[model samples]
Target: MRSEKEMMDLVLSLAEQDERIRIVTLEGSRANINIPKKNDLEFMEEVLIDDNMVFDIDNLKGFLNDTSSFGFIAKENNKIIGFAYCYTLLRPDGKTMFYLHSIGMLPNYQDKGYGSKLLSFIKEYSKEIGCSEMFLITDKGNPRACHVYEKLGGKNDYKDEIVYVYDYEKGDK
Candidate 1:
């Protein structure tokens, strides 16, 4: 098997090169501030790449196949450290847009600008595809992610419950 770091680099580089990949987001318990317990497969399966952690692939695939999704894991050396996943939706106007479903860096990788690098790639991709805008939903609970988005020039467009809609126009990226 390839090293985890190698795998992460591959995923990010591929996303950087492909315009069809409009955005990269993350999902699952990893987005939760509370690190998940290892005993359950449900939470584990929600993550795209668990590294040495065991998860139910069949369950995860089933859940994702029902939607338009793309995911990537970040690695350093041979170890997996972070991930992002995005879900696409068709608007009533017949325009296609994608949401930044989830994004997370492993505890050790946080605040190191890796997330920005990934987001930059995603934004550039969205522009190349002629997308009008890109959106992301984050919680007031996850202020760190919000801060990151703001630093990247994201605008707050809407919010309901804990979900905050961070939007970027096509020309800005």
Candidate 2:
């Protein structure tokens, strides 16, 4: 397994070299009262666990039923290297936007620039599917990821908003 630093390095390198990647932005913030002080790694671990439990076959079937929902994986020699989950929807004004829910590379593939490849694919695929913009969240303490987003020309103008989340199966709090 590759260290987090190595994965970060590759993500940054790809952002630097890729012209298709635009608008990289951090998602998690210090003001997020739900998650106090978890760093990127910790946040990712929690997300990984949640995804495993949430993306069961039945859930995926429902997700697939929604035309705006999409998921993709990066593979090399038939081996999975990375994955992305996203949802694109049309607003009341007829504008289309997508939320990049997750993007992650396997530890062993982190340094190989596969994350960038996966992101690139997401951009093109989103465009192909009629999306105009995409957004994602990253932890505030994850400077490495923030740097990559900045390098990719992502803007971070949002500030001071509380994130409210409710899992469908877990029911409302």
Candidate 3:
């Protein structure tokens, strides 16, 4: 565990390097994870402990039966190393795109060329399927992901785009 000051310094260093991080501390806002303020980590743990999980096997079965989405797994000597989930999207222009998500690789395989190769394969597969575009969330904070996407000719048309997420069905008071 790092001291709060050390952690702050590290965050400052990263913010300096990332243009997406416009403001640093002494701008004086308390983050949820900040040492002096709310502990979202503990909150997350408590939520995990308190919430009862119920899996809908029928829903999963229906999804498995549905088309228009697929996953690509990268394997080496019969061992799966990486995977990317993609869903087909039909645009108003009558062209299709692949909405890529849930891309992941084993920790030992990460930072290797396998991730690049897997992504490249996905692109090629998308092209083969007549997809006009591929869309995926590549946050600039993830410099490694950005680097890989850039090498693959991915474009960022909008800088500093704000994303809004709506979480469903949590009883709020």
Candidate 4:
């Protein structure tokens, strides 16, 4: 298995080199605060070696399930600092669009152009695939992501409750 840093470096480098991986999206409760705990086996083991047994199976399952929905990750120096999850929606107009469910960079890695680089790659990928447009939904409360989407040329189409939909043509960038 690749070390965490190796995996992260690979992800970022692949994004840099490839053009068909349009619009990385992230989804599921991994972004949710009430989602439950994540298993930190390495940390836990290191901290509590004397314990007979302490595991939260249900929490582990939930965390695993949440992470499974994300199809890709962006890493820096072998650590996962960002990720995107995607889902495709076929419009009634016969146009197929890809929706970016979520994307985030680690706090320390924010504002380093990694997000834009990943998104540019995604947009190019969408164009190659014959997709006319790409869409994203973000919580209005999360202004940072919203700002990124707008800077990337996403237009707001609808807003209700906790989510806002932003869209852009494949080559709008």
For each candidate, the alpha-carbon lDDT, in order, equals 0.55, 0.55, 0.56, 0.50
Query: Cα lDDT of model 3 overall?
Result: 0.56
TM-score of 2: 0.62
Residue 113 shift from truth in candidate 2, angstroms? 2.0
* Most lDDT-accurate candidate: 3
Worst 10 residues of 4 by lDDT: 28-37
Give per-model TM-scores. 0.57, 0.62, 0.63, 0.50
Looking at model 3, residue 24 earns an lDDT score of 11
lDDT (10s digit) by residue, model 3, range 1-173: 66544544443444344322221111112211112122222322222223332323333234334567554545554344555557888999999998886566667778877777777767776797799999888676899988888888989888878776665666433
* Superposition TM-score, candidate 4 onto the true structure: 0.50
Assess the local accuracy of residue 90 in candidate 2 as a C-alpha lDDT between 0 and 100. Answer: 85
Query: lDDT of candidate 2?
Result: 0.55
Q: Pull out the clashing pairs in model 4.
A: 4-78, 5-78, 22-122, 23-122, 25-84, 25-85, 26-85, 26-102
Give the TM-score ranking, best first.
3, 2, 1, 4
Candidate 4 lDDT, 1-173, residue by residue in tens: 65644433444344344432322332321121111112222322222223322444433234234422223444444344565556556789998787776665666778877677566656655566667788876667788778888888888865543543354643443
lDDT score, residue 90, model 3? 94
